[model samples]
Target: MMLMAAVLQAAVVQPAPGMLVERRLAEAIPLAVGDTVRVRALAGSAQPRPFVVAGVFEREADPNRIARNDYEVRLHLPDLEALLPTHDRVDRFAIVLAPGARADPAARWIESVAFGTRAYGSAALAEETSATFRVVSRFHDAIGIVTILASAIFLLCVMVIRVDERKRDMGTLRLIGVSRGTVFRAVVLEAIGIAVVGSVAGAGLGVVVTRIVNAHYARVYDTTLRFALVTPRIVLIAALLGLALGTIAGVLAAWRLVRVAPQKLGER
Candidate 1:
């Protein structure tokens, strides 16, 4: 399942021409300036209240406004207050710190005036988000481990079968006075070549698939949560891992073939 908390945190908000509507929402409902939109004042309200679309904005003014749904709309403070049941009370407030200003004193002052009010910094939000997705992160790690192990096992099986089929060729090399180490090196290099090709192809396909999936997610959720990111470091790691697996499998197969007498291998 896609993690919603991460998506909400990464969403970008920017200044808009007028009142802002999410990009996806604007596309779905085609609103223009001076147009009127109805919103439900309260649950089970018989009639929806109409508000003028002063402007339709795609960007957000505040980053803290966590909107998970695509059908989101923003309005001016006064207009929003006018629709609420209690004009005096607000759900939350955000304060921006100026340069050279301290946060502790301001937080203390705000708490003293308003009971039950809590102040948090950007770091707190990051900590909370990480905690929320800890399990998901662990699951992803487990999947990576399983994939590596499966790849190693599959390569081992294929190399073993290939060595069996080429027994006569190995015997011929041995009869021609080729050193065991040289024969083993040749087999390992061949396996590495095949593995490198396959790994590179797989990585390319993975990158394309990841981009398509991420685009679909943005279109559907209107959020910027990337499912997969293929970076240079990731590519390097994959390539190294593929080479290691191939080397291990090839060594095992070559060892088994070399242990048998050349005369016996030739007879088989």
Candidate 2:
């Protein structure tokens, strides 16, 4: 009862007129605590109102805000009203429900009370807003598939050339009584080694590129949001995929060499 009473009393009371400025806005305007700033609403012809800066805050690092990057000022309801010509009117409201409260019911109740207003759950809002990202993700997936296909084809070609170059040596080994299985294993092992080395080099390059990209973004945006990330899991997946492709390519190339007569392989 005491806690509820205190909360009610606090709700009934209004704090002194002051606004919190966004970090970007504060830095751009060079605002500090206790500094006075003149602000005017863009919607109305009201003259600029003097306001004391209570605090400077960093905006939440969110995907939605990254595109807009708008400056913001948070002030009391009365102070906001005084700055603009409008009175007792609000464009939007954010409601926080208690634990175990259903969003649909709360949203319905809010819409019932507030005519001409639409309320959406977090999931619905995300689904509606994330269409662009979904499209971009699909495009990236398509590009990745094409890139993998190209890389596999290129690897096959490289293996074929390498095997062809060593044909005479392989023929000599076979003449010296080296078994077909031994030669096949040698080629496969070479492919596996190439895949391992390539995967490591690629991972290193990816990490370095990600760092460069993130640094550029940080310098430009003054935010810590990273544009690219190279995690261990991703690196491991690439290595495994490389190994699989390399093994397959090696098998095909080795088969071409082994099926021919040793005498034919010795020819230029």
Q: Local distance difference test, per candidate?
A: 0.77, 0.87
Deviation from native of the Cα of residue 257 in model 1, angstroms: 2.5
Measured with C-alpha atoms, the lDDT of residue 192 in candidate 1 is 88
- In model 2, what is the error at residue 89, expressed in angstroms? 3.9
Clashing pairs in 1: 13-60, 14-60
Q: Write the per-residue lDDT of candidate 2 for residues 14-82, one digit (tens) a residue.
A: 544688998888899788999987888888799887788999988777766677767888988878888
Candidate 2: C-alpha lDDT: 0.87
Clashes of each: 2, 0
Per-residue C-alpha lDDT of model 1 across residues 194-217, encoded as one tens digit per residue: 789879998999899999998987
Per-residue lDDT, model 2, residue 258, is 91
Model 2 misplacement above 4 A: 1-16
Worst 10 residues of 2 by lDDT: 60-69
TM-score, candidate 1, is: 0.76
Tell me the spans in candidate 1 whose CA falls farther than 4 Å from its real position.
1-18, 38-40, 43-50, 59-70, 99-113, 130-132, 222-225
